[model samples]
Target: MSQPYLAPAELTAEFCGRLLDALDAPLALDHVCVDFQAVKSLDSSAVALLLEWHRRAQAAQRQLELMHLPSALSQLIKVYGVEEFLQIKA
Candidate 1:
């Protein structure tokens, strides 16, 4: 398995801003995997986060992977009709 960037338990808009700032640096890996094992709660911001991450990865010609997504987050992705835009592996 690939190394994962552990996601926070709360993936809400309040936390997303900080999270984005933390990840604003250039990505060193061609493939980035974000693990949601610790994410027990989330809102629509989760999808925005994933989309922004995916956008960054794509801009760098890299691949972004999502792992162990919470069921609610998964459903949100679908509800937003952005499932095709993300690479969810779990």
Candidate 2:
């Protein structure tokens, strides 16, 4: 498989808007995987971005996969009770 897309070092509210805007382009593949290894910090906005991505992927008949999520981000997703809405992989 091809390498997954790398997430930015920061996925905070201050940056996620731009990140979301960047995702406006059409996905070139049926499955979209994003790697979070470079993401050192994030907030609830990250969750929002994931939700939006998932929504977009579903609308386009594509699948979204997230990998290597930081523990903090994982906790935030769990805390917000949105894990069921996202597809996270180890």
Candidate 3:
């Protein structure tokens, strides 16, 4: 089981790309838990990160879960109608 814990500092496109690119590693695993407690800002790229993870997870027959989501992140996901897809219940 492999997982990447995201930090607010990692909410950039480059970092997100690197992280998403690694989703194929430890291929046996099928879940990603993103820690958003430190995230002070919500960006489209970050949403794409989670969405991409969820997309990859689904495509790869897996799942994506967010941990300790800030209000902003939660609201953003809800706004984008991805709460259901990403299982954003935190």
Per-residue alpha-carbon lDDT of candidate 3 for residues 1-90, written as tens digits (9 for 90 to 100): 455555655466656666666556533464666667777655667778887767777777766656777776677788888887777664
lDDT of 2 at 24: 42
User: Candidate 1, residues 6-59: lDDT per residue as tens digits?
Assistant: 999999988887787444453554477778999977899888888888888888
In candidate 1 the C-alpha lDDT for residue 47 amounts to 88
- Show the colliding residue pairs in model 2: none
Off by over 4 Å in 3: 1-4, 13-15
lDDT of 2: 0.81
Cα RMSD (angstroms) for every candidate in the order listed: 2.3, 2.1, 2.7
TM-score of 1: 0.86
- Candidate 1 residue pairs in backbone clash: none
The lDDT, on a scale of 0 to 1, for candidate 3 is 0.67
* lDDT of residue 58 for candidate 3: 77
Flag the better candidate by lDDT, 1 or 3: 1
Clashes of 3: 0
Which lDDT tens digits does candidate 2 get at residues 17-90? 88874444545554777889999889999999988888887887777778888999999889888888886532
